[model samples]
Target: MSTEQNNIRFSRRNFLRTSALASGGMLVGFNLFTACKPEAKPAVDIANLNFNDFNAFIKIADNGYVTIFSPNPEIGQGVKTAMPMIIAEELDVEWDKVHVAQAKYNKKEYKRQVAGGSQSIRFGWDALRQTGATTKQMLINAAAAKWGVDANTCKASKGIITNANGDTLGYGEVVSEAAALEVPEDVTLKKPSEYTIIGKDALNVDLDNIVTGKPLFGLDYKADGMVYASVLRPPAFGQKLESFDDAETKKVNGVTDVIKFGDKVAVIGSNTWAAMKGKKALKAVWSDDQNLESTVDHNKELIKILDGKEFDTRREDGNVKKAFAEADKVLERTYDSPFLPHNCMEPMNFYANVTAEKIHLVGPIQTPQWTAGRVAQLLKRKEEEIDLEMTRMGGGFGRRLYGDFALEAAEISNLAKKPVKVVFSREDDMTDGIYRPAIKYRIAASIKDGKLTGYHLKEAAINSNMYDLIPNFFPAGCIPNYKVSTKSYKSDITTGAWRAPYTNFLAFAEQTFFDELAEELKKDPVELRLELLQNVKDSTDEKIEYSGERMENTIKLAAEKSNWKEQKEGVFKGFAAYYSHNTHVAEVAEIEMKDGLPVVKKITAAVDCGILINPTGAINQIQGGVLDGIGHAMYGDLSFENGKPSHKNFDTYRLIRMNETPQVDVHFVKNELSPTGLGEPGLPPAGGAVANAIYKALKNRLYKQPFIKELSSKKSEVLS
Candidate 1:
């Protein structure tokens, strides 16, 4: 969507609503949703304040204290802090003087309360700025009226308004009068040059609380008379609960009751330990009626689908067949990536109190509105009757986008006739299998006269439910005679978004292919990609999904920062670039072979997400994403045998540890463009860069994921 389409406009009727404060403070609320649209207004209990609305309220006391409510979930991506920073910047308030609070979920009031797709900032950029600017304008207008001067002559800075004569009044002193002033329709937002808070390093609002072990995360939440529950899931995919003997479970100390709902069995107890123990003792039996497919079987099915001619064409530019037939050389290869688990630090958990008339749920979730709608449908209740509260999540990577865990908690609470928190153990979380879809890509490219001629890609996967695995992504617009085809195989294994979705695998495959082509053509990998992007930039197309100039800029910046042309004694460098979520990123990896294994020494990244809201936060996000991508490419994988997961926990599965972490340096291309996404863009290029670097170091191309295993076997072969 264009920026204008995403711009939010507040009606005068709902612009600023004031309520008398007990401490003689001013309470100003800004409704973020459209007032003209009846459906946009959520049914909220004004007296009790029970709703999930995107609206924000500022509480300013006579003591110059300011509190702002952030209206999105904080899943460790730093939205809780970055969002409030945006408001504080436009409000002309000092960072230390402003406090932030989390807002509840109210769908009708909050247009988009989702965290997935890395869209929280992108979607809220204009709306949130307008919110702060509008409030600041009101305060300025009030100060001008008090001083009997024009509003334009008055200036506001650091929570203080000053008149031409040098007379000043604090925001708190004028907040009451500002609350009674009319809100302006078009408030002026500060230009990038005038920003005092944005682009500067600011401590996270929750940093102190986190370090102090405060109760902020969902796992730390508690309630009066609330019990704990643990669920026993099916042993394998396509299985249904047949029978269970809960006699021993109920007899255990602290174990209250055992309830069965469809394929899941829940054991309630006084605490989390008791519930887990009781669940283990339940010993439920399941019936496997459908086809029990394993990872081996799924791989074979994907291969078959790829070999078959039947496919859905997603994009076709030129005559690929003619180009391939007339080319001097045509190279084709297949890349495979296995299904991976999210493994959020805090296992899935949610607390719910479901009664006949209402449902109250509190937990860590990415999509509160979508989950609330699903819960309302399941319980045959109105959405207004359900209060879904979002808590700080230890990590979310997209697993919390599903509402199954919340539904399970609500079901258990309804059956127990009390408030209950459903918790999933590490074993349960790893084995349940809502994983990143295992994917295979058959890529072919034709080279003629040292110039790229044609490119073709065919993607085969288990399902296309969460995100369509597009074959033509980045290089599609850059290369001529390009074609993309897709095929899907049916499977019982559940799959959802994991970080960057399909781009995570596509970047590895496409960028690696580009590196191979560069080697074949005797050209620098970075220069070759820049040439393709240059072609894209010179094109006169009416619309382009990605900006070639931005991509080229980031690529050049990364290359410059990483000293691409210079090489250390034994260090090998590789380069990769990709565009996703409207953000362009380029990364270069430096590696050295130590003890027959490739050790990543350092990584240099350059991102073009337009203006940087928080330089420190953006850098942190890029660093985290780089590490996560490296970890997944090096050690992440999940397999199954006879429809049951082969890996039960971290013992069987592998994850990147602190010892394996590499030093990452991040830089952003300076621009005045509006800010884009940051959460997942930095990840896609990390895998590709590392894979290409390893290939350069060892001269052995690894086409499969979990590069550590493949490298180990290659090392053994070299020794033998």
Candidate 2:
């Protein structure tokens, strides 16, 4: 096919429009080669092979260097390096010769540009491999044509094409010819046995840049002629802007303008510090007559809702009531987890330059396409007129999934009539909302013949409408009769997706309950879980959300690696296993108690995500997730009083520091199944493991999060 003809057939926009393999969806076959025309001119370098603006994913330059564009955001998950490594493996190129670039948000071109739900690698695995394989075939075909040999007889290795006769051609040498050739409709992919890069311990591409403190994060983004902006949002959830006085703020040095947008007031200045000072000087007043709910009121409302008859039945099987009635005993317990703030290290920040012709936005965001769509709607402009770019995120943990910060920046820039970078101070970010919902779980299990015959879970939350509650959580299908129901109370506090979402709280409640059940039955907790999984494995169901074998394997591996059977003088072990984002994870926590406080010492984790793209990156993700889970479970909590968050900053709202972090060891199960997500699976189980260990050490049950304070209160009451 002529380059022009190929371009028409395989243009990014048309390709994405026609293909069913949208981003974050199941993979489908894509044919890059269909129609062809006679070639026009032969340029020696592929750099000059500008075939009608065809933006092929894999680009070969004249210097034999290859560039691959990663489509997802880099949210400290190591996707930036691991994804391109997949392409390099199939393209048969040396790791050092490959360069990775972050692709901007282009839905029509990239189809789905999102970094949420831990679906980046899962959705990109097949498509990215096919991209590299097809490009390699084109290069091989070009080399074969030059040598007058069959294309099938030419093999590509390390950016070179070789024939049976020992004749060879560098990928750079045949780039022009390759670009003129038609893409292969079907190409062979390398088997795991033949991979040289996929399973290896490849270092992160940005490691050097990060180590040297290079400017790569959204907080470090800067543009020429850009001003700084700080916004003062409503003090309370249901409150609205009443009035603001900016005359005094205008007198502040470097202050430019004070812009108001409904519930927010933005202060623009020559620098970030000045903007913050000017924002404080505005002394905005907000209307507080809406009678917004407080945390204590919400908790009471949740309990009242749980007591009410109204419920949404997510999943139910068999006769739970009958089984409970026939049981020898029924154990009931209620667990609560307080709301939490993401508290991302970098805080929320974004840069925007909105003009009459186009809007330019650059920042750290997990969902770029969604943000672009929102910006287009807000600005009353076409999607094409907005340019969105992503930078490396300091930390996401589901906070970046929302693009409100980016929208605020764009709004401020448009009103200011200049480029503006919206910066959120730590205090502003913490109190500005979008928090993890406070949740309540009431569990009841029927015991018959020393086994669980029936199970019922009733979950109540504030604004459950924001997130879908899963009725069929872990151990759902494993039991004979199971029932799960949910209820919610309405509130104005903004709630959003946190790491592992529902699984985070569910695992803690379910696993800790199981530990209690194990003691009641005089059986080992790990053994009891395995027994339940065995029932799932032996079941005749045609569909199961989680792999029984994978879950069982990880549980066994984690126990074995953590020395679950061993007894230590001062260490107590706790075990937990869960499945989320299509990945199975089992963790064992070793904890010690000192001075009436639980001290976590170490955590051993086993994960089954099928295949590992980069072992080093995988381990890093596991460690980070483990620490985050532990930190939040131990000290994370957000409360409201008088219609506003009582904990305004880190001082009142506790966070786990480095000195409190435990050593983490991670292990991946050996498997051949297609890869799954890694960003969140490692987290759901950590809380349960740590909480269970604390219970073992203290002989006291912790039914609420921010367990440090709970334990302290219990100890004080006992002393009194």
- Per-model TM-score, in order, reads 0.94, 0.92
Best by TM-score: 1
lDDT of 1: 0.83
Q: Rate residue 291 of model 2 by lDDT.
A: 55
Task: List residue ranges in candidate 2 displaced over 4 A.
Answer: 1-56, 294-296, 466-469, 540-543
Cα deviation at 36, candidate 2, in Å, is 23
Cα error, residue 265 of model 1, in Å, equals 0.7
